[model samples]
Target: MSAPTLAPYVFKRPWLRNLLNPLANWYANAAGYRKLGLRADDLISEENAVVAQALKRLPMKENYDRVFRLRRAMQCSITHKLLPKSEWTKPEEDVPYLGPLIAEIEAEAKERAQLDTLTVVKNH
Candidate 1:
């Protein structure tokens, strides 16, 4: 499950977004995933049921791409080298490919839980 976040609140305030944007960018760059040719979503652990489901639900091409990125990252890690700058994942290319799927799965689970506990009343 995703951690609770103040992202919505932070995003709603222009000043806050402006203030944090640079720091966020700097942190992302410093995280080194992009240097290894991996997107932010690639760093999400698959140990969670939600993430695992999301991964399984990924489109075939996207799944293939995710696998390729992961393997490439692993190889780079093993070799103790980063991808060339030209091939490093650009900030714009680091979108959350698996996040929406995970959200959808979580929503479905919530709905199912609600439905499972729903009570029906008899009408006179």
Candidate 2:
């Protein structure tokens, strides 16, 4: 499950978004995934069932790309080296490819749960 956050609230406030944008970028850069050519979504842990399901739902090309990024990142980690600067994941390229899938899976699960417990009443 994703951590609870004020992201929605912050995003709705232009001033807050503007204030945090630079810091968020700085933090993302400092996190070092981009240095290894990994996107932000690639950092999400896949140990949970929801994430696993989401991964399975990815399109063929997207799944292949995810695996490629992961393997490349792992190789970089093993070698204790970063990818060349040119190959570092640019901010624009670091989109949340898996996040939407995860959200969809979660929404489906929630809807299923609600339906499972649904009750019907009939009038005479």
lDDT of each: 0.92, 0.92
lDDT per residue as tens, model 1, 11-115: 999999999989998999999999989999998899998898898899999999999999999999999988999999989898889988888999999999999
- Scored against the true structure, residue 51 in model 1 reaches a CA lDDT of 91
Itemize residue pairs with steric clashes in candidate 2.
Answer: none
How do the predictions measure up, each by TM-score? 0.95, 0.94
Predicted structure with the largest lDDT when compared to the true one: 1
RMSD of each: 1.0, 1.1
Model 2 scores a C-alpha lDDT of 0.92
Candidate 2: count of backbone clashes, pairs at least 3 residues apart or interchain? 0
Which runs of model 1 end up more than 4 angstroms from their true locations? none
Q: Where is model 1 poorest over a 10-residue stretch in terms of lDDT?
A: 1-10
Q: How many backbone overlaps does candidate 1 show?
A: 0
Candidate 2: C-alpha RMSD to true structure equals 1.1
Q: Of the candidates shown, which would achieve the greatest TM-score relative to the real structure?
A: 1
